[model samples]
Target: MLLTDTHTHLYYETDDVKRAELVQRCKYNNIGRLFLPNVDAASVAMVYSLESSFPDLCYPMLGLHPCSVKENWEAELAAIKQAIHQHEIFAIGEIGIDLYWDKTFLAEQLQAFKQQIAWAKSLKLPIVIHCRDAFDEVYDVLLQEKGDDLRGIFHCFSGTVEQANKITDLGFYLGIGGVVTYKNAGLDKVVAQVSLNHLVLETDSPYLAPAPYRGKPNESSYLIYIAQKVAELHQTDLETVANITTENSKRIFGV
Candidate 1:
């Protein structure tokens, strides 16, 4: 069964150069595609480098992460725009309101988020959201700003069923990651009720590792455990889980 990790940061500047080998491991484990997202101006080069090195296997996204929002948000946004123009990005992603970490730039984050959304809309591209602890606010933005032009995935979706319904209503898909395999993840209930059409597999690697490897750094190879857990939760077979999630991924990413 083939799986796709729709969210992952395999090209961290501080990360070791073992990422290429990690990609090999993911291929060995059937996690064939990698969707790489940029955090800010600093990450554009790295995001492109990895995508350039593995064009057929790895895809890149141009977006400013919520955590990277700050006083110089305009400059950062300009840089993100530059990346979009400089490379063929897969989507405008890892972009959304994240109030959990710091609210100092919440206002700026909101503005930047909307700007990116409009930019993506103008380009006729889908977005990949990174919503963390600001579901209501994020949902509000989608409702207010999306307006049929916006469509994408909610990365690392660990929300209530009501939230899932709302997001998909906006023509988006949920990015279920290794978090679903955790003991107290609470995603089993979510996936049990949500249809396979609304779900897509992701590892969010170098983060949110699954149950068997919960404490370890995540990688695409661990997506099989996530797919298994999802299949079991949805009362279906592994192949069905892999196939549908992959199709959902392809639909959202246009790949």
Candidate 2:
């Protein structure tokens, strides 16, 4: 069974020994593909370094995360854009409106999100969104920019069935992660209701670890747990979940 973590920040683990252990764990768990989305200019190098170290296992994506949209967001975006040009990226994201942490930069966040969407469109690449508490705002922008060219994954989607429909209708895949394993996250219910055709798996590592490790640091290796939960929710086998979700990742990343 080959599983794909459509979103992860495994690059954050810089210790070579520990990082190798993380990758080895992923391999042991059959998590063959890991997509890394850099949050800002500073993280671009980290993302690329991990990808280079595991050329066949890690894929890199570039974008200005909404939470990173500070006063100097323009400069950050410029740096990320320059980096995007210098290397091959599978997607332009973990970008979207995130109003959960602070509402101070809502306007800036919107601008950054839209700008990154434009970058994805221009590059003919998919986007990976990080919607927090601004799904309405993000959905509105996506509606405005709706087209054949706009397509990507809604990373770490923990929304309602209605919202899931809205995203899938836009040709975007719903990125399910460790949250689904939470006893009360209600994401399992949503996943059970939605078809696997419009769904993908992720870990969003260094955060949102699944149950049995909920309060600990998350890693791509734990993706097997998330995949197992998804398989349980869908009433299917692990191999089926792995096959379908990995194929969906390939569809989105074109890799």
Candidate 3:
């Protein structure tokens, strides 16, 4: 069975030995494919380095993260756009509106989000969104840009079923991550109701680790736990979950 982690920042590890170990663990767990999304211009090299090291296993994406939107966002976006043209990326993301930490850059975030969406459309590539506490704001922008080319994954989705429906209806898939395995995250209930066709698996490593590894540093290898939880929620087996979600990833990344 081949499991796909549609969203992961495993490149953040930096340590060659530790990074290799993480990749080995993922392979051992049948997690064969991993898509890497760089948050900003500074992270582009890291993402490309990981993909270069494991060219067959890792796919790269470029974008400016909402959290990274600051006073110098215009320059950062220009640098990221230049990097995007230099490489063949699978998607343009881990981009969207984030209102969890601070709302000071709400206007900037909206502008950056819309600009990235246009980039994705122009390139005919899928996007991987990173929506936090700004679902309504993000969804509003998405609605404004709705089209055949406006499609991607809603990364690290921890929203309600209604939100899930809204995303799927727009031809985007819900990126199910470690939160689905949490006991009280309520994402499990939402996953149980959403069809597997509209769902994709992710770890968002170094961030939201699945249970047992929760509150600790996460890695791509832990994707198996999230997949297993999804399998249980969907009343299916691990292989089925792996097959479906991995196929869904292929559809989104086109790799």
Candidate 4:
């Protein structure tokens, strides 16, 4: 039962002891691969450091997150581009529209998303998107940027069946996470509607922990619960869910 955490923020761990513990827990839970998504210049170093420390388990991605988009976003994007050249990034991601927190940077966020999408296409790498309270906005940009070259995961997807179909139709995978296990997230219904082939597993660690651990600090090891919930939703076994989503993750990250 080899599971892959398609999205995690191991860099968020500050202490060496906790980081080591997290790695051991993930190993015990059969989480063999963890994809780390970069937020911006501030997080690039730590993201790369974690990947460097666990070359076999952690793979790093480069991009500018929407929430980080501000007046000086151009400089941040430039820094991200420079970092990409310096590091062997797996993808261009954790990037997209995020209007949940603030709308002050909506225009800048849109520009950053589009530019990052262009970077992904140019580099021939998949992108892991971070869409929040901006589905229509994200979909609009994706529609404009849709093409054979655009392929990636809609990270942490918690949308409706119609939205799920639209994302899958665009050749993007839906990143299923702890939200699927929530009491009334309705992600279970979405899971039932979308084929497993169009889905991948994620934890968004230090964020959305699965039920029984929801609202608590999430970790890669907890991916088991999310996988189990997905298995239940698909009416299959846990190993089946893990295998399929692991393969789907590999297809996207090419690892």
lDDT at 60 for candidate 3?
93
TM-score of 3: 0.99
Question: Would you list the C-alpha lDDT of every candidate in the order shown?
Answer: 0.87, 0.94, 0.93, 0.92
The sequence of per-residue lDDT tens digits that candidate 2 reaches over residues 104-176 is 9999998898889899999999999988988999999999999999999999999999999999999999999
Checking candidate 1 for backbone clashes, the offending pairs are none
Candidate 2 Cα outliers beyond 4 Å, as residue runs? none
- Over 4 Å off, model 3: none
> What TM-score goes with each of the models?
0.96, 0.99, 0.99, 0.98
Tens digit of per-residue lDDT, candidate 4, span 5-51: 99999789978899999999999999999999988899999998898
Highest lDDT among the candidates is held by which one?
Answer: 2
TM-score of 1: 0.96
Tens digits of per-residue lDDT for model 3, 124-168: 999889888999998999889999888899999999999999999
Candidate rank order under lDDT: 2, 3, 4, 1
In model 4, the worst 10-residue window by lDDT is: 246-255
Off by over 4 Å in 1: 13-17
lDDT of 1 at 140: 91
**Against the true structure, what is every candidate's RMSD?**
1.4, 0.6, 0.7, 0.7
Q: Candidate 4 — which residues are off by over 4 angstroms?
A: none
